[model samples]
Target chain A: MHELSIAIQIVEIVEEEAAKVEAESITRLELDIGLLSGVERDALEFAMEEAIRGSLLEKTQIVYNFIKAVMVCEECCNEFNTDDYFNSCPYCNSLKTIFIKGKELNIKSIEILKQ
Target chain B: MCGTCGCGEDEHITYRNPNNPDSHLHEHSHFHGDKEHSHAHHHEHDHSHPHSHDHSHDYLLKPGGGALNSQTIQLQRKILSKNDLLAERNRGHFEALNIVAFNLVSSPGSGKTAVLERTILEKGSDFNCYVIEGDQQTMNDAERIKSAGAPVIQINTGNGCHLDALMVNKAMKDLKLPENSTLFIENVGNLVCPALFDLGETKRVVIISVTEGEDKPAKYPTMFETAQLCLINKTDLLPYLDFDLEKFRQIATQVNHHIEFIEISAKTGEGFNQWYEWIVKHRLSETD
Candidate 1:
């Protein structure tokens, strides 16, 4: 699954950041994954567990902040939550809706303990 | 780490010849630092500098009262930023060479290689064409493209589902493509993961054969939505299959209103001219 690749990338990013701060160990990591980001949460967690073995984040507690997909209708200005891209606006039945805030896949923060 | 997977850092991508069982190995290490960190920061205050202390003023400070200060670093960085930056570098390279690169994506048996073969056969004399073929572990596509009379390179991605921008950048260096040429990057035959990666192609063409169901556009909207053109291949077999052309078009258009579609049969050359014309026109427009 692509989740393994993504998980590895997350670990790499965390390791790089932790090295910059000279952290003894990472205590926690928070990720912001959106509903429309095309990532499965459980799969990512499993992949991360596999990816972090013997790595700097081996003991880190991972936290996920899932963002819900919200679409804004261009025709009727209606805002709705949806996971599908082909969804139409509920109020106006228009397919001209755009995603306002659902595609985010980011590492929001990381807690590191200094030696 | 393997460029595709982060298992280990020393893994090198090996390019092997399809025809020869034991051809000379061409090993290329994944280029690190190709992607620039857009969010690099410099702290003004130095944490390593110890604060001034007075031993006589022990009354002012209590021993063992202060706790270790753990820091929470705010990154707010996009997960795919590295790939995006590398893709941008590839775009810059393409622009500098005036090359129009097309990313051909499709299912395993969707005739992407056939389309590229036919395109090269028909237009090879008029233009310089280069191909970069991607597959999990095969040089068959590269062999086919080479036989079609064009320079071709094969990238065996071992375990990667899709070709990232870094792979393309490496392939470009090996290709030595000429200026004002068309580079066709035949991505690994999968619609899902490739849609998430940007290969710095000027245009993305997704091919779907008539043998497949009309619900493919609805099922994999991300690939259809990301593509600029949808080449509906195997129109010659439409009479025998139960594929609904109208329904497919409707769903595809609903998913991506800006996408252009062309029905063609690379075998019989039916509606193939239109496909070539579309490419030439877009290439001209991009250059202009």
Candidate 2:
């Protein structure tokens, strides 16, 4: 799955941070994965488990904060939640709309203990 | 997810040329997110710096029990920023070389390779063409494109589902990408994962054959939404199947307001002129 690659990326980023700060072990890993970010949570968590072996994040607590998919209707400025695309404005019945905030995958923060 | 050995860990991604056996194999490191391309690659950050940290990212340090200090680094970095940055570099590279490239996306058996074969064969005389084929395993598509009389490289992604910008950048260097030519990157067959990655192509072309459902656009909306063109392959089979062209166009347009469609059959010479016209027009518009 693509999640393994994403997990590998997470591990790489954390490893760089850990190395820069001389962290013995990363205690926690938090990620902001929006619904529209096109990543599955359980799949990512499972991949993270495999990707962290023998790395600085070997014992890190992985926390995922899934953001809901929300779109703003350009016609009426109404915000609506939908899992799929092809959404029409519920309030104005207009097809003009775009995603506001559900398409980001970011590493929020990391906790590490300096040796 | 490692397809080759099934060890659930990624192996090195390889690029091979079926036509040139002497220079067929080129292997690269699997550290996708790391800036290092080689095992001996050094980090720019000094390992033994005296100052705490001087990075652009925010730092929050609190005293731990005794001498050991535990700190929280508030780094709001995008996961694919490395890939995105590399993709932008690739776009600049293409601009510098005056090359027009397209990242073709589609499901398996959607005739992506077939479309590539035909496009190269038809347009080879007009302008130079090179290809990079991506799959979990095998060099089948690359060989086929080679048969079409073009320099081609096959990127075996191991268990990876899609081709990242790093893979393409490496492949371009190996391809000896010429000036004022065309490059087509045939991504892996899966429509879901490939939608998230950008290869820094001039445009993305998503293919859907008439044999598949018209609801594919509605089903995989992100792929359609990101693509600039949708090539409906296997139009010759439309007579037998229940696929509705009008409905498919409507649904596809619903997801992507600007996605243009061209119907064609790689097997037969149907709607090829328009496809060629698209290649020429887009190349002029993008490069010139």
Candidate 3:
């Protein structure tokens, strides 16, 4: 659903970067996807391919790296990695938790072939 | 090959490396070493290169895609930053116009529409009311507001789970909104994806009705934490439902202490006056 819109944003960013670096073709796009980012990787990839057609980023490979969700328990102060979107702390069973990492949707890097 | 440094400048650039003859990696490396020194590398080849191949220049783009002057542009563009930039643009636009737009988010059947309906009925005449309604289908909510005599536009997401700023921008175009209008955007009935997107709204109003369960604030705390105001709607249904209004307030406050909570029922016209008063106060403060 939001993947198509997200894909459009991806295309816009890549196109802007291509223009900035004065590059004619984009070879690779690297993305860091967080576990709790709620973005479907396969769906996003498929959407990106369809969205990038007839654009400057045609025939580009999208390299996505998924990061596991991590959080710190407010009660026990224990930090743990979890794939669970919602779960109590394993140590204290307390719902008071602060998210440390994951939930990140960023373009980590891009490889453009210079003309 | 040059024997001293193993740099291939010799007469025979063989596909086989003189060292490690039995290793497969050596054979593969030798193949690439010859490939890099192919006729394309030489300026005198008279096919592609007009200038002599500079030893200093790094020829990263392999000449593969023919005749479009195909230069591959390598970049590290943050996908989220693009939206953030547009979001900032929208924030600036709102600030310049002195308009306060709020994105209302909640679960389905959370009394968001009722809150708006009651709000419009009470204070629609005082301020220019405009709404951007997001739903999977039907302009029913928009129709309701239009009959109430407020400027309303319904955005049928078709299957979209959230409303992005770009869609808000398009919806605003048709609104013909006033210079300093108070725009209320009722996001699609979703607690998750809608929390991630920013619609250039000054406030993010999260509605939590009593029937959905008290643990809603604890379970889906992101929208609660992110919102500026948390309206606990449908208070009239509190007695029949096993919903603890006090417990809900306690958990919601723990998640967001600074957020203002208004418990009201848009239906039956109970506790709506307080919401109306708050809106007027906010609008006055903003305009002042």
Q: Which candidate has the highest DockQ of all?
A: 2
In order of appearance, the predictions have TM-scores of 0.86, 0.86, 0.69
- lDDT per model, in order? 0.79, 0.79, 0.67
Tens digit of lDDT per residue, candidate 3, span B146-183?
A: 76767877766544566666667756665667777888
lDDT by residue for model 2 over B55-144, one digit each (tens)?
Answer: 432233334434545789999999877788888999999999899999999999999999888888888758688998999889899889
Sort candidate 2 into its docking category.
acceptable
Error of 2 at B68 (Å): 3.4
DockQ computed for model 3 against the true two-chain complex using alpha carbons: 0.16
Best by lDDT: 2
In TM-score terms, candidate 1 sits at 0.86
Better model by DockQ, 1 or 2?
2
lDDT of 3: 0.67
